[model samples]
Target: MLSHVEVTARVALTSVAHFVWSNRLEYAHDCFVCRRVGRTVSLHPNAENGLCHSSERRLEWQDDIDVAGAHPAPIRVTGFDTAGDETSQRLRCRLAFWWSPFFDLKRPDERASELSEKRWVRLHYRVGCHVCRDAGHDDWFGPQNSVQSNQVWPVTSSCQRCDTELVTVAGPPEINLVG
Candidate 1:
């Protein structure tokens, strides 16, 4: 039999792997964006200015968890660019997990019934521009323009309304169990 630690590790690892793999496409897509912009980006919890964009050209998934009885889990991932800062940027992705027996999870007795309590996971991506801005100007809009001056600001960083820090994860939950 597997020790509790082993079982837990397996489960956690599985969870993480599943999380990473299931979201690999997303990660890759984000990485592609960062690469195109020539900057490093992270796709995990606690990332700085990490959130994704919505169809409406607005930042998506910026809410925090507040389930009644269960807790939340958050992870941060980061990525970087290789072409140097001129056209480079840094990206951060944050994922939050929320649990609620009533809505998110099923009762203990339903474990094997395909209705077991489950945690709801929410993902957010934040891309920050560490280089020069306002590259849309004619002088900054050329193939040979300075890499730093020729970069376009990421839509993920600009607030739709206020145009500020587009997204921010809620404070870490007070209760979290890793077993």
Candidate 2:
């Protein structure tokens, strides 16, 4: 059997509850949960999304946001045709970030009065329950995307609902190059 190819689903702009910055002038993006800096990237680069957005496995609605300083920015989310197909219509402002109330530590590079285990780093993870998905068919019946935090988690996990083993796939495609 042949599987349909759709790489666009993996292309996305990720926004964590908080950003990870480098100790030096360089900026970075990492798996905040593990404090693993895969590589350092620029804050802004002269680039464009060359991918054809004319049509793809994406929402028809797009959000246009304008922010200046701490001001409440005026935002707009609309579709070319609101009354169009439901599958093609979605909002970009999905509430997918969670902040830990116990977030209480400065960046690791920052000097502290004294070294102590009380230090903490906010965590984040992209989780899914393949078993709960019921052989990759159910959507609403499974844990889709989880935004959570804790000191640490096991490298491998189990389906909260079905107890199926879950493991993080090896790198490369799992890391969003466009992100």
Candidate 3:
């Protein structure tokens, strides 16, 4: 039999794997920003190739992002917005869930009908700013930009209201459950 610690560790590991696998495809796109200048940038899928959206002078930006820190962070789905159609809304929900840091790989296919019926996709994670962690500050941790595809913005100017690091989990109607 598994001890409590063992069980917890197993669960945590499973959760991490699920999150990584589900969102791996999404991150495959070059989605990153310059931590120093707050300028939007992209990292090549192949890091060894040393390719980036900016000039070669900015190559150091890739090294500064700390991709490892982007993983194993707690996440939650917070909310949802729809322009009109249910199908479109569902697609958006799926996309959001795919990018979620707390993504659960087990739930979706099993409950496809239910989710489609409700016109909602479960947002399983929250996004935290790694730059804040590197700065030795915990006050601003939430998404600096609105939840858009492959976009990163400056957390300092955007998250000035909250002194504690702000983690924006999927909230309200978007995420069916509260964290």
Top candidate on TM-score is 2
Q: State the lDDT of candidate 3 residue by residue for 35-85, as single tens digits.
A: 111212222222322211222222223334444324221112222222322
lDDT of 2 by residue, 1-179 (tens): 11111111111221211111111111112222222221121111112100111211112121211112111111111111112121221111101111111222334553221111221111122334534554554541333332211213423334555555543212112111111
lDDT of 1 by residue, 1-179 (tens): 11010000000111101111112112111112111111112233234332332221211221321223221112123322112132222222232222222211222233221111121222222232211124232322112101111123321223222233322222221112223
Ranking by TM-score: 2, 1, 3
Task: Give the residue spans of candidate 1 off by over 4 A.
Answer: 1-64, 67-108, 112-119, 128-132, 135-179
After superposition on all C-alphas, the RMSD of every candidate to the true structure, in Å, is 17.7, 18.5, 19.4
Q: Of the candidates numbered 1 and 2, which has the greater TM-score value? A: 2
Off by over 4 Å in 3: 1-116, 143-179
- Residue 140, candidate 1: how far off, in angstroms? 15
Write down the lDDT of every candidate, Cα atoms only.
Answer: 0.21, 0.22, 0.23
Model 1 weakest 10-residue run by lDDT: 2-11
Give per-residue lDDT, candidate 2, residue 126: 35
* Candidate maximizing lDDT: 3
- In candidate 2, list every pair of residues with a backbone clash: 60-88
Q: After superposition, how far is residue 113 of candidate 2 from its true place, in Å?
A: 4.3
lDDT against true structure, model 3: 0.23
